[model samples]
Target chain A: MNLLHYLRALRGIATRELLRFVHQRERFISALVRPLVWLFIFAAGFRSTLGLSPIPPYETYILYEEYITPGLIGMIQLFNGMQSSLSMVYDREMGNMRTLLISPLPRWFLLVAKLLAGTLVSILQAYAFLLVAWVYDVRTPLEGYLDLLPALLLSGLMLGALGLLLSSFIEQLENFAGVMNFVIFPMFFMSTALYPLWKLQESSDLLHTLAEYNPFSQAVELIRFALYGQFNIYACVYTLSSLILFLSAAVIGYNPSKGMMQKKGGKQ
Target chain B: MIQSIAPVLSVQNISLAYGEKLALDNVSFSVHSGECRILLGPNGAGKSSLFSLITRLYDTRQGSIDIAGLNLKRHSSKALGRLGVVFQQPTLDMDLSVERNLFYHADLHGLGRKQAKDRIQEELERQAMFERRHEKVRQLNGGHRRRVEIARALLHKPDLLLLDEPTVGLDMPSRKAIVEYVHQLTADHKIAVLWATHLVDEIFETDQLIVLHKGTIRFQGSVPQLLDTTATSSVASAFQHLTKEVR
Candidate 1:
């Protein structure tokens, strides 16, 4: 595609995603509520029962409420990314996907533009959560804001790529709900969202090792380190690698000539 | 099939299946420039599958489709660019303003801001939606939304247009208006039109008609040829007879 045409295509797909989010008020609010529910209610209930342990990035045991902020932020991006792809499946059923797939630009570019738009939305939601955290007096270094931007972007892209990968393979929209049961919850709970690796290591070594290797855990770690104005090389590497890997897999999964989606969705 | 100077669209022995269920069986037909081909079929008759193949929505298991001389598998996006499609479902964004929806489609076609604005204005006027341009799609009636879709489809000046059961649910007047307008466009613009519908009255005597049944083309000829004999006086009756005979 020519440069001018490419820009317009990107603009079109991006704007469509944004407009969809804006139009669906209940959906946007629900996305925010899921993270907030964990932060205010669930986190509060577990705050007292949880024994304080010195988490790595922390010099001393900190409040459970404060410790989980980064995890909540990661959770928001993860769920929103999946939601974006789920909507793509919905769009396909509704016939809107046909409009997009028929556009005279490379389908990969269009899909990437969609992922970028989802990341934008996730980042915006994360910022809103940050504002609430600040009000709760969960303080971080001033430099943390600057450091966290790139980390948040990387995490967003990583999660967005995963969502695209899922969208490419799932045959029907009904199967997406099953993904939440089988994939989403497991990934979120097995990661370092609620507790650090050291804490999990004491409870179960195998589980701790699994969490440490989970790419999502690395994403959460990257965000956690950046939130405290620290650099995390391991997290950075893992997140980048996952981003490339998921995107490549999604591209292969969506190859129109030989993709399974044609076999599944080609019928009337 | 009769030869033409240059066929705008062609399908060659295309067969599509959904696992054990076949959706299209060796369906082949060609429509030349300026002709209107109405694919008449009942529900589950594989008309929609043919539309999907022509638009390259899914790869055919057996056969090929070409649009404006470009093979679908080789040049899908380019082929789609030359074809405008309005599916049975309304694809416009309901929350955005009508004009905004048109602008988004213009961008999809890679039109510049100035050119898109000009073309949007022209298309809206053509569909008499210029006055309601600022209204949100959620507020518009069903017929108006369909008009917006048709207007959006025309933005790229396509070589061929496909309307898959475009007026599936609409008041009689609204359906008549769309039918008349599409017929006018086919003649005026000389763009080959493939209008898929089940209604017999929608098929004109001059328009080429094809009867699709169980994923295959049962009969393809003018309305009169298909309605030649046996109590099958109307196109719908003829279609029912052909499909029943196949069973």
Candidate 2:
């Protein structure tokens, strides 16, 4: 295909996603409310009990809200990614996906376009959350706002790829809610989103190990460092590798011949 | 009509299976330009499987399919570029205006902005939907939605159009309107159509017919020829006569 054609397809797909997001006012509100509730009510309850040791980014101990801000940003992306995948399943059932797949473009390119669109939406939601955090006085360094852009984008793509992979395997919409709860809860609770690794270790050795290995924790750390205008090499490596891995799996899962959907008796 | 013109769609001995169960067993057919061919089959006669294969939704494992002189397997982009499809299920984005939905399809086909707008306007006006172009698809009746889908499918001017049971849930009048529209397209635009459905009423006496049952073609000819072969007076009884052994 011509380069102009590919570019046009990308633009069309992205614009369609943005239009859908705009129409679903309730979805946007709920995406914000979930993280805002945690930032306000949950952080308020834990503020007194939680203590932080001086870390590289933090010269001194920080407030609970500041500490959890990156995690909640990560939360917004995580949920948005899963929500986009839920819509993919809905699209498949509703037949809109058939219209998309029948286009002359390569299937992988179409899927990546979808992934990029979802990531873009998640990033927009992350920025909205950041603005809300700023309004709540849980502000980062002013320069850190720009620095966090790349980190937030990478995290959104990684998490959205995970959602794409999950949607390809999920058979029905009713089954997706359970899968979302299983995935979102563990990935959030076990990560450093709400608690530091050392805190997890103090709670249990298994929890500490799980937190260390959790890709979500690495994503949060990447954002945490970027929000302070610093780089965490380990976090960057882990997040990039996970993004590649999940994205490849998603592409494979959407393949018409050997994909999970084909194997599961989709539209035969 | 030029007698030497190549068929718009040529399927050669395509066979498909899901594991050990055969879904389409060496099915083959061709539709020449300006012809409207009907693939008449019951719900489980593998009509959908054949469409899936032709559309490349499923792989062609045992045979080849050619669209407008391009092989589906080797030259998929060129082949698919010449094809249009309206699936059994409604594929419109309910939240978007009808015009926006058509624009998306146009962009996917790589039409430039000006060209896409012109084609979209022409197709919508032809389909009698230009007045309702700003309305969300959810607000339209089922028949109007199907018309919009057909308009979207034609935006790229594909030479071959495939409709997989397009009238499954429509009322009698709506069904008649769509069928008549497609018939008119072949006469006016010289576009080849493969219209798959089990409904006998949709088939005209002069149209070509392929009757598939249990993953094989029981008959392939005109409606009159099918009636003559079965010694039956109507398409319905001829279909029953042809499939009764398998049933």
Candidate 3:
């Protein structure tokens, strides 16, 4: 209704998420641990076998840890976005989403606000993961940490918007495992999260083109450049456009009158 | 009989269809301030579909609904602001404390901090739940949880209160308490209520009743009028006599 009203509602929605996140210690632990295990165990083993030439963000050849750090950060956000969407699915199933949907606020605004709340949580996780990566000697220039903030915000929103898009389509909680298999794995593996596009090209031109076009790859590239205190206009533009595309589709998909989620949930 | 100076809730020629199946056909109702109008129907009698229409969970394809004089389609914010709902299923976050849940709802409605606090306290105290405000909702029994939901719904001081089978699973004592409390609410606050239920025993003598069967209204009037028309001695028999055409 007013600016203050909007602010208050956003604060409430974000605070509810924070409270829920705090209560789920297992969730926080799992989110953090998933990325770390890859950084430590997976990257450690791959570091020797996966020698890389200097990528755009990298001036010299780097270890697999450095190469995959941005990928892992992308991984954190990718999973966080889906995790947030999973919560939305859970809320719909549990009837809590109806409470949110019934709020006097505009539904698009509520959903966008929900998307933003999830981005905030994922950013926190990104920074925590960065902290651990720094401890592992995958250090960025000191200013890169500050520079990474906005990048994390942008990439986080894109991935969270993707999650919003997915949550809008997913009807039940039981379909979560299937979504992870279909959405998460393909997006992660087919992207530059673990390797550069050129490397994929050396292996397979088809996979290389796919990785180059992958929005997750662009998000990782965006983060990869930012952490080195550089800016990739291409990655920035690609990621932003993808975010807009995903968010628009998500908002439309959630409309009661026209969207695919027209069937009321929780009664079943 | 349900109309007042102006209806708090007005549903005009509302019909809902799921593919070829008509869930509601030209159903219409209005509730004025201080009126408790019951939508009595067996399962799949279009009660949920109608509630979905009122709540804007589904689009109003063939009709319009106005709440507190604001069109739900054109001015949903204002209309929704004047509405309070306790859905059929539990919607509270099990991990959040009672006050936390209520406060979050208040925030969603954009209630100011002081106003939210005061209303939360008043509503919780009214439900005899102020003492347990710090307790998690998961700790509350089914009846108590329902009470908390009712309290939360009333906190906004809505002009129209829609309860979709709020007492479905409660024990008799709890159900009776909620029924009595809601009746008092409309009386004391002049709020219009649309309570959907299948159980006949939950009906109060003064309440206006509408019996729905197969997506159409079978009967709607006073209890005595229902008996008079059906030539039956009791509400249950009258309901049976009215809906006996089910095949």
TM per candidate: 0.94, 0.97, 0.98
* Tens-digit lDDT track of model 2 for A89-144: 99988789878878898888888899898889988888998899889999989989
lDDT of 2 by residue, B9-110 (tens): 999998887778788898888999889999998888899888887887777569899999999988876788899999999999999999999889988888
Compute the interface RMSD for candidate 1.
Answer: 1.5
Instruction: Please give, for residues B81-142, the per-residue lDDT of candidate 1 as tens digits.
Output: 89888999888878899988888888988999999999989988988999999999999998
By summed lDDT, the worst window of 10 consecutive residues in model 1 chain B runs over B229-238
lDDT string for model 3 (A1-268, tens) is: 7888788889989999989989999988898999999999999999888889886878988889988899999999999999999999998878898899888999889998998899899888889888988887889899999999899999999999999999988888999999999989999999998977878888999998888899999999999999999999999999999999999999888898887766542245
Looking only at chain B, model 3 earns a TM-score of 0.97
Kept native contacts, as fractions per model, are 0.68, 0.66, 0.76
Score chain B of each candidate by TM-score: 0.95, 0.97, 0.97
For model 3, name the residue pairs that clash: none
Report the poorest 10 consecutive residues by lDDT, candidate 2 chain B: B1-10
Over all chains combined, what TM-score does candidate 1 have? Answer: 0.94
lDDT of 1 at B64: 84
RMSD (Å) of each candidate, 1 decimal: 2.1, 1.6, 1.3
- Candidate 3: CAPRI quality band: medium
